[model samples]
Target: MKRVYLLVITLFLLSLNMSAQKVYSVEYANQANVKVFVVDYENQADLKVFKVKYQNQAVKNEGRWFFTDYANQADKKIFFVKYANQADLKIYFVKYANQAGWINQSKLHLMY
Candidate 1:
């Protein structure tokens, strides 16, 4: 019984440590061929408008606001997105899969 209890406790701790968490309002920007999947909580996120200014022009084709949670597409080094309303933004670069659709995968970085 004691060993079983220890195992249960260990599992609980591990789960807690590995829990996926979202920030109050955060964005991740990466420069690579990656598929990004987002789980939005718009009401809670307090999202703002964002954009990637390329050659001094906002990529309006990308869209107006990035959104609370949605998979973003990327094919080049710079990706423009609108969160809601912010002069500056914080981005977190993460991994992505190049499958048919975006799949939640581990954090990735371009090694080369």
Candidate 2:
């Protein structure tokens, strides 16, 4: 019973960590975990992103992102590419938080 409680607590903590979408923008593509391209239209995007002011508000892989001041503080480091073909993920910035989400489920792993 004690082991089961510990396992539950551990899983809960890991879920919180995984949901925090803290990101850093890298200067070069080689320094990044994912290469991203900004789409002019929302329909052309793989993910619809919403920039959140607070780190706590950036929860979930649902496209809510918090930009960290330091690279070490981020969960994922990304570099913006000029062309769509050079990108691992294409994103569109959304005006509202509710509009943020993944359009292409196959490209979802790139954020993780």
Kindly list the per-residue Cα lDDT of model 1 for residues 55-82, writing each as its tens digit: 2232222122222232332212323345
Name the best candidate (by TM-score).
Answer: 2
Clashes of 2: 0
Measured on C-alpha atoms, candidate 2 has an lDDT of 0.92
Candidate 1, poorest ten consecutive residues by summed lDDT = 97-106
TM-scores, one per candidate: 0.23, 0.86
Which candidate gets the maximum lDDT versus the true structure?
Answer: 2
Runs off by more than 4 Å, candidate 1: 19-81, 84-89, 92-112
Superposed by TM-score, candidate 2 places the C-alpha of residue 17 at a distance from the truth, in angstroms, of 7.2
lDDT of 2 by residue, 1-112 (tens): 9999999999999876685489999999999999999999999999999999999998779999999999999999999999999999999999999999999999887877
